[model samples]
Target: MTPAPFFYSIFGLYLNSNLAIPGLIVLPSVSKVDVQVSFNEFPPALQTNIELKQKIWWVSRYKDENDRPLVTIWQLENGDYWRWEYGDRTEFIIDRKGTQIWANWPNNLTLEDTVTYLLGPIFGFVLRLRGVVCLHASAVAIEDKSIAILGPAGAGKSTTAAAFAQAGFAILSDDIVPILERDNHFLVQPAYPRLRLWPTSVKALYGEEDALPCLTPNWDKRFLDLTQPKYKFQELPLPLGVIYILSDRTTSPSAPFLERIPSNNGLISLISNTYANNLLDKKMRATEFDLLSRVLAKVPLRRVTPHADSENISKLCDVILEDFHKLSNNV
Candidate 1:
């Protein structure tokens, strides 16, 4: 007999999976299943009836030994399905409706290896396919609203969020932030209850290199556990209050500060930091442009430049909370 499927909730969607996904809070049962994931054996090559619409050259920074793209995606069945191929011989098929996912991998890899991609890029693309606006950022819930930390990969987005967690704030989402516009404001959905951080950031925030446990035995990434009382994880959506675009660290003597940016520049930043951005087709791009345009008009955008010292995470959080409070008072 087959084992019972696992139920999980994330990005405001109910998921029923054939395998238990790590880092997610498992629910005993869900009222409705919005997405289903199954693990099955697949051949080395896939055969499809529909014509291939488009092939994304590459989506990830890593590349194969041959210098080719580490990951490639094929839009199939006239956008009804998406096929992903990885350098390590892992594969996944997702429906455009975002309701179904099937994954297969080689014998050498474990479920944890596939899960890293599944939880981040795979689900992020699923959200995009479902018409949700997502950013490659981390979000933290303050008093009544949340703030999204936007930046490039090494720009300290997770580090800043970890600092906020230490300061007694609730983390809404990490890595992939899903936002829904409701009641004339954007609300951020809560992701899982952990923050993935590099060793450098972990040392900076917690004063030790091994402050947090490894996310997976195969990976060097560490994760800050939000289930601990020291950290808070927000389960409900919070209206987005502010957007902070993190700039590169500054070694100058000045303290950390926020710089207000123009809407046009902010829009460029938003477009640049969108999740699964490389896979967006013309129509999807248009939809994202319109949604972000509206967000720019309504939300306040600030550029935060932090000190070069890693231990200054608290100072960075202080400036951010000060600005967040000031904005709240003005509103």
Candidate 2:
């Protein structure tokens, strides 16, 4: 059956797809506890399951969602079928086509993160078959250009990104940003509207008592809802600009510093910062490597080591912005 079209704008990368299954069409709800989702492929099994539940929130589990099995896998005739449930109200089913992803998500929640996670592998398959590339980094667009934050898990990538957002800098993505080659230039898209911060970090940013509302209840991570209208959450895509690689030096008493590095060096540093899940197959790793290499070649990279001081977030933001402005002027 023909499905209704749902439009999603992530960092300016527009995706228009249908949000319907065989007997079910998931629509966005106005409730705050509602779930948003997207799917790449729709399998009959998924349709049947959703039809049975009628309304429930289910996302990928992977120790992220109340320890529930977030991802459901089913073997299909053409390829493997994967479904991601976001809590109890949203879900997405994908058909593992070599190049195309029959993807769709709930309109209520931003599907940026879900899309970015799948885009890497989906695009990787396309690029390897067609010889293209992708990267593992966080990107934001400032002044119509995209700037990426690259680093390891413990690195302050998300923290820095949140600081920038607080300073009125529009956040393009939190953990992942897809770099697509268009018109002989690179275009970055937003990955999600939420930033996952550690509870302690959240306390530092919003204050211990203040950050409580943002906490994910029993979860260890605190989610900052950038989609709040007050933040003026931006959905537009910006051009690619600067790349900052984060490092933690909180144990030291020194102030934060930003070091400019050659493109090759920057690329290597980014490769080291990638967060790879254990379930990712070899093909996924190869694809990640290719994408990281391509991104490094196109953008200027910097290493940003932020001091571990509890009060250094604001200061770190200022220092990074100064460097960004300097680079902007030189460019």
Candidate 3:
């Protein structure tokens, strides 16, 4: 009798890499990032294993051209992973093997440069998928319940999340809060231990903003390690209390401050605010839509039109807190 092809679990999802692709083995270790992939065909790269800082489990496949490399970085921490593919003629599968880094880079590009460029986005995407549904907006916990502040890229999501963090509410997730359906309830998961904020918002929140770690030398964004300050980075999931879709009302100053949209409209709003919809296909989109519809059925949804200024943070938080309290008491 033949044995089962693959067997593993991450964040409760059963992974069968061998079944999905022949000649692939994904082994993830506990404590520190360490992953080992065994390919029946390709031999291990000799000098490549020395350069990695951590070991991450990964799976890769040859594209139709047999030159492009499609890779997935499986980081054991938080049970997260990401899938990416390089162009034809070069393929690299970089992952952490415990504290040591591992890579399968094509001979053309230097391994160091590829790791540096792909690490952040790949990590971000992995974290986003696992528990945090990276939204294009910010999130705040009000009265122990999370209120998502939704909007476009520069619509102050990070600003709002930071302000709420400063105002004593725990930061549930920033940018993305993965919304999952479990027995009729929606669970929001925090994406990462750090929050990436624009420089302007950093200065606004911390005053002398030089303290934040620069993600890139010239980029306007910085990464703040929330774990350093003892901010509760939720490892388990939390029920999503409210969805507040934020829209800048500077152009329409006289419009109502807040309005409750229909559940379907709210679902559309939530879908529009997703951070990685581009990667989703029709089937995935439908699945997400179904999951979101069920979520909206339980949680109240609101549309908040606020003037894009400093004051918006306080006002929005205040309103959300009030609503959260009302909901909790009723529940």
Candidate 4:
């Protein structure tokens, strides 16, 4: 069956996907040429027996006994990816040109589950193949520039960015913020305006656990929709300002503070916080490192430690905004 063409706006690119990506911000129409997405059947064999790493029920990357990454086994030829969720399965065949997604899922699971895995790690790898540097960060537009908040899982990156919107700023993205370098300046590619938050975060912000719609029917996670024009998303890529890596409060409860990360420590922090770093090969890692070196020279790097008391969220945002404007003047 030929699926109806679907359009989505994300990662500063117009996507034409044959399969419905329900999570993305669907576009009614677009005329630009960008990446094409399609769904089709996959090959019948594992590309190679060699295993580089095995992730639980998600993906197992392959490499030979010599520690060399296995080349593609597809007739169309690029590489192969396999994913499983509770025995429901998916296979991806992709190259720098585009991607073809195929899947089989149990009736019990929701389509959101299928699409999440499809777009999450799988599409992240796809972007890397296309030479785009992505980060596991959330970003917000502060006046004229973008500030990306980087941290590990549960570091409150999304919640803090959403707080910026509450403080009269616009959001650039909630997760997987894409950073690009052009014309000798780093730019932040805007993502969908929605912010996915946990139940605890939802209660903390709105005092209501159901303040926002859930991302999936079976999930407790809710979405912070910023569709109103006043607090709407930034549609275009804005010049990068600074990258702040958030840390848990290990200090006494004074106030949230920002500390600059020296140039020597910048690359190590970025490599650790980058999106899809685990999937990169040797050459890709070198390219990513080179790009970060140039980006750090232009964009400031800092470590942000929030106050121990959750009520200090507003104070943290105020200080960060002050610091962001102060640094953006030079960028």
The numbered model that scores best in TM-score is 1
lDDT of 3 at 148: 75
Clashing residue pairs for model 4: none
For TM-score, candidate 3 versus 4, the one ahead is: 4
**TM-score for model 3?**
0.63
Regarding TM-score, does 2 or 4 come out ahead?
4
Worst 10 residues of 3 by lDDT: 16-25
Who is ahead in TM-score, 1 or 2?
Answer: 1
Ranking by lDDT: 1, 4, 2, 3
Tens-digit lDDT string for candidate 2 (214-254): 33233456666776655534465566777777776755655
Question: What tens digits encode model 1's per-residue C-alpha lDDT throughout 1-331?
Answer: 2334799999989998888888899899988899888876432234544234556534678788878678888776566678898888788888878988889888888888888888898999899988998989999999889999999999999999998888899999999999898989898999999999999888888788898898777678999989987789999999889999899898877758888998768899899999989888788899899999999998999999999888677889999999999989998
Candidate 3 global CA lDDT score = 0.54
- Evaluated with lDDT, which candidate comes out highest? 1
Write candidate 3's Cα lDDT for 259-307 as tens digits.
Answer: 7888657878878987666555465567677777777778888887766
For model 2 the local lDDT of residue 317 reads: 78
**Cα error of candidate 1 at position 191, Å:** 0.7
List candidate 1 stretches off by more than 4 Å: 1-4, 41-62, 65-68
lDDT of 4 by residue, 1-331 (tens): 3434788877877777767777577778788746666555433443454244223322335655655433222323223443332323334444434344454455666667666555666567666766778889988887778889999999989888878887778888776888888888888888776788998878777788898788877668888778866577888899888899999865566669989998889899998998888767687788889898888877889899987666777888988888887876754
Question: For all candidates, what are the clash counts?
Answer: 0, 38, 25, 0
CA lDDT, every model vs. true structure: 0.87, 0.57, 0.54, 0.73
> Candidate 1's error at 155, in angstroms?
0.2
